[model samples]
Target: TTVLTPDVLIIGAGPSGAAAASLLRQYGYQVLVLERQHFPRFSIGESLLPQSMVFLEEAGLLDAVEQAAPEFGFQFKNGAAFLRGNERTHFDFTDKFTAGPGTTWQIKRAPFDHVLAKQAAAYGAEIRYGHTVTAVDVDGETPCADVVDEDGFAYQVRPRFMLDASGFGRVLPKLLDLESPSNFPIRRAVFTHIADHFDPAEFDRNKILISVHQQHPQAWFWNIPFADGRCSFGVVAETDFYAQFGDLALDDLLPAILASEPSLSKLLSRAEFDTPVREIVGYSANVNSLTGRHFALLGNAGEFLDPVFSSGVTIALKSASLCAPLLHRFLQGGSVDWQTEYEQPLRRGIKVFRAYVEAWYEGSFQDVVFAVEPQDEVKRMVCSLLAGYAWDESNPMNNNSVKRLATLAEICRDGRAARDALGQA
Candidate 1:
């Protein structure tokens, strides 16, 4: 077996891997990326939060992404629209208190991920496609990964440190027995892309649409439209909720589920499924630790919460950005505090998103979001969080989101009571 050596070895070519590779290369490290699949492959998480642009710019990939935007038919996204029956509300990212660009893009993940990997390759990171890591040994001073290519050529790679950005593959976690119980219950999503022609008058293509099921409080749907006139549609609900449709094929299950949500049904009335229906279940995961003796986890490799509010890519980029500088320090022989510097700060933002996600399903955040007239400051705070500024401590909502959300929701409930009393008088 041939032996390869690099300063850093990354296990996946997904967003987190590519971002980490790009940033590490900028810090003068020889980075090797291994991917089990080729580029432009099917994956979910197409929508991007505005804060991701900062990390892209830091990695010098912003221009490439900008050029590919029009070439790949990416839609410019300014905000998100939430709908539940007739109660509609929109939170414009631009209106938030964040300092960076208020708008981001909604692109096809396959090509978008390809572009990111390509950008990393251009930056001198060696990305080998079809290389699946079968085993990893991180107990040694130098971490090593055993890999096999599609052609069945096996090899070993030794790197000073490893970054497991393998996403849902969770390569390191599974190999090292690092898996931990997640706080979230099991959830499933049934999704597909559709060729939908949108009437600009009826739909604001500039923002993603999130519609909650009128009957099932635990259920929610996403409508992410692209510039190519195609939209990604999906529904997420508890696993038990989905089991009721057990054994039903996606084609039939999708239509049957969509019929239950009126807003989504009307919006997708003329749309036709352009791709086969796909389903993913129990995606919420966590790890016992984000780092070990010679390696660290990035993005979904470490933890993955629910996809409501589109936090997956944001957290992935955040993990990559957070891990890059500290990894650089370790490579340079500087004593790096892994837990204090890398994991704590990273999980802080994650906890903020987690609170909001839990509140969303509990019906409190939904009530606050769909309020007839919410306080301007509170709405902006919520918008800032939605825009991926969860780490900004200046935003009280980020500092203690659960308490603030509960308070705001109570205010909303009280306001409704007063209005009803006045109407009766």
Candidate 2:
């Protein structure tokens, strides 16, 4: 019977957990991170937002990421381009309203997650791969978990506090029955990697390309390019929308769907779909409580919005950034309010993103995005939100996203109508 004790216990060695460990270790805390999978595991979220760079730099892990960028084929990204039929526009992150890092990277999650875990280890955090947390017990004064190692050795870990950074695993939420129904409708994504034989002069490698389906604007494709000339391509839509292509394997179905989008079809006409296609269903999730007695859920464990904006990693890193300092203060015998100080602020940013996601699916946000002759100031404000500056209270978009977006949509429509009338006269 082996028992271990640490000042802080983190479940999952993904971005959030790894970042939390690094931050806590910087404060001289004995932090232990348990990860079920070994290094270089496959993950779906590859695109990153600029705001994530702030958290990585704060955790002192950005230098390692930069050093390993060349090895992992990380592609430089400064903005995102959107296309719907003949309408096309792009938002340069560097021109956003909020002030921060303007550029980020399109990463391969396998190596990206590994780099983060190793950096956390380098910062003196104890990370054990192939160790899975089977059960969690928080009824006692100290939080603890039952874990089984790869070799079948079982042990117990008791830590003064626990942070659940399990990402999609939702370890504590499931163990503690904290799950709740999400407000978002069920949606799914089918994706795979391709060897894109793109001409550098023809395609802009510095931005991610999002193409809307000509027939169904709600369904869209994300083309994320890597430095090695391969691209991560995926299509997203409501779960029922996929039912039309019955019994079609991802490999066969993806190509058929791609042909339906004229713009994307033409762009990737020379691409080779060499890898296996994959699918993820109903990934949107929510929980009843974010913090409960010596423990707090981080990232997807707390809540998850749509992936249309690529906010997953940013939210994960932001959670780690917000939780670490509060945990340190609590460990130092300070009265720390986990709800107001940690959970509320994190949810505020998430709420801002949620409003946009709702508008994206409902078509209001898309109207503004594709609006002809959009106001420059309005574009910058919306660009800030797109760049993952969801927490900036100074930005008007973050404060009243839904109302402002609706108003903007109406104005765009009216302007278009007036233009049509003038042309007829």
Candidate 3:
């Protein structure tokens, strides 16, 4: 066994862990990142929001990410058609945030995560791949962690502070006896990546493309483009939907469902399959406690919402930035009243997500607004909230608007009634 000491110990090397380590290093704190796998691994949720771009720039990795930027676009759905073609919402980074791009790039997450982890290393974080954390011992004065790497090598991380960013790995959840279940009837994800299925020369690549299925309110799909004309598409639906794939191969299994959704059917009419099918179950969680003892839960480790908004990475980075300074204080032989710094913000974020998810189910999503066209002022205000700006107090939907929307949604809980004139936006 090898024993190594660091100021901060981070378990799980996804965006949150990387962000924590990167920011800690910037503060001259010795940070150790323990990852179970190597870099450049494939991941889903390839689409992004404009606010997320600002975060990447803040982390100093934006310039590096542009080398692989896909075309910028947003495809909002109402009936079957996207309200705009080529023209979409590029608001934040365009006329308002900056004249830069106003759009977030569609990316292949494998290389993207790798770039972020590498940027952390460049910022002076000590990252050890294949270093899987096995167990943890916690105390406010001293915290101990045990990690096992491949080849049966064991190492100990004795850090003054710890941040668990092991999303859905449920590290802190298990310790705290927390339960995070699938909130919707939809429980699984079936997706695939195909080459030659997406080509800028052949298909519209200016905005993010989407397919809205009218039959099920829960059903929708994304078609994201990356380098080399590769395209990724998938569905997040009820777990039992797996029965459809029972007999036929994916290439053969895709058509029947495609035909059910007019929009998806039209887009894939000319495209061809290029890879094997893949699937994952959807999960939702809310921890009773986000901080305790000497450790803290960051990002999905604290809790996770659905993937519909593509918010995993942004929240990860932001949460890490929020908590890094607190950990830094602990590392400096100073006592940290972390709860004083994190409790309110954490509760606010959790309440906001709960309200948002409740409406997604309770309201039949009649008022659930997606960006279909250039939005009017109030519409954009709601869209910005959906786009993950809930933390900003000045934002319309942050305080009063969400309350108003919640009241409206409650009044129109049933499907037909939600669409009634009184419920009109």
Candidate 4:
């Protein structure tokens, strides 16, 4: 029966947890991170937004990531390509109105996450792997967590403050009963990695391909190419859509669904599965509050919108960067407002992404994206949002995304109608 104490205790070693540990350790605070899994474990969310670079740099992980990128064969990504039938549109992050890094990378989460966690360890944060936090008692002045190691050795950790970065594990949300209904419906994704023999001349390896099903607009596929000639492929659709396949092995289901998308089917026709097909269901989640006495939730521990925009890692890193400074101040015996300083601001950016995601699924934003002639300024604004500049107030698209998107969609509709009338004349 050993008791460990640290200035702060983090419940997971994912991006959010590691970022927080790295930042807090820079402020000379002792950080203890407990993780349920080992390093280099499999995870999703391969595509990254450019805005995440700032946070990584701030956490002193940029250099490590840069060195590991090439070693891991991560692909350099400057933009995203969207396709529907024969129409195609590309958004280059460098063309965005934002004033930050324009390019990011499409990485395997296993190595990317491991690199970030290792960087935190290099910064002197104590990260313990294979230690699962089973219970947390937050009623007292000092919160304590019950952790069990892989060999079933149990211990207690007492820290002045606690940060829950347990990701989809939702440690605090379930233990504290903070779960709330999400506005999004239950959706599912079937994903796998493939060794793709892509013709470099035919495919722009610098961008992720997002292809919409010609017949099933509600279903979409992601083809993220890696430098190692392997691609991460996945399809997202409503749960019922997958349920129709009912207990079919993922390997069998992948090809059947992929056949529906002609473009994706043709592109990956020469590809072979490099890993087992996997599935994730009901990933969209939310909680009533992000903070309580002595504890706050980060990353997926608090909320998750949808993966359509590839906003998960960006949001997670944003939460870590936002919460660390505030938590540092509070630990220094200063009064801190978690609601105003942390939760509200964090949710503001997430809300921006939420609006765009809603419009995307409803097919309104697609109209603007595929418009024959779109306004340059509007395109730049939308590109800024897509580049992860959701918090930039100078961009009107970030402030009123739904309204602005609707207006753009209407403009496209009118232009099409005018062309149709002229043809009739």
**Tens digit per residue, CA lDDT, model 3, 1-425:** 67788878888788888878877888888888898888767667776655566667766667666754433212211111121223223323233311222466666777777877888899998888887887777743688887888988887888877889988786867765755563556566667876535434435653455454566655556666654556667766666665855776656665556666765565566676767777676666667677876888888888777765566676777688678777777667678666778756755654565566555544333333432223344444545554555566665445654565665455444333423322344
Using alpha carbons, what is the TM-score of model 4? Answer: 0.96
- TM-scores for the candidates: 0.96, 0.96, 0.82, 0.96
lDDT by candidate, in order shown: 0.88, 0.89, 0.64, 0.88
For candidate 2, lDDT tens digit of each residue in 1-425?
A: 79899999999999999999999999999999999999999998889999999999999999999999999999999999898888788889999889999999999999999999999999999999999999999999898899999999999999999999898899998999999999888889999999988777657888988888888878989999999999999999998877777888889999999987887787788999999999999999999889988999988888999889999999999999999999999999998888899989999999999998898888877877787343456677788888999999998768777787777777766765322321232
TM-score of model 2 vs. true structure: 0.96
Per-residue alpha-carbon lDDT of candidate 1 for residues 1-425, written as tens digits (9 for 90 to 100): 79999999999999999999999989989999999999989889988999888888987788889999999999999999998987788889898866787999998999899999999999999999999999999878798999999999999999999999999999999999999989888899999998877677878988999999998978999999999899899999988877766678888898889887787688778888768899998999999899987899999999999999898988999999999999888888899989999999999999999999989999988988887244456677788889988898888778677877777777676675322221232
In candidate 4, which residue ranges exceed 4 Å CA deviation?
243-247, 372-375, 416-425
Off by over 4 Å in 1: 243-247, 372-375, 416-425
Return the lDDT, model 1, position 117.
93
Q: What does candidate 4's lDDT look like per residue over 1-425, in tens digits?
A: 79999999999999999999999999999999999999999999999999999989998988899999999988999998888988888888898877999999999999999999999999999999999999999999799999999999999999999999999999999999999989988889999998988778767888988888888787889988999999899999988777666677889898889876788778778888768899998899999999988999999999999888788999999999999999999999998889889999999999999998898889877776777333466677778888888888888778767776666677766765322221232
Superposed by TM-score, candidate 1 places the C-alpha of residue 190 at a distance from the truth, in angstroms, of 0.1
Error of 2 at 250 (Å): 1.1
After superposition, the stretches of candidate 3 with alpha carbons farther than 4 Å from their true spots are 67-101, 179-186, 196-204, 241-255, 333-335, 361-375, 400-403, 406-425
For every model shown, the clashing-pair count is 0, 0, 4, 0
lDDT, candidate 2, residue 326? 94
Scored by lDDT, model 3 comes in at 0.64
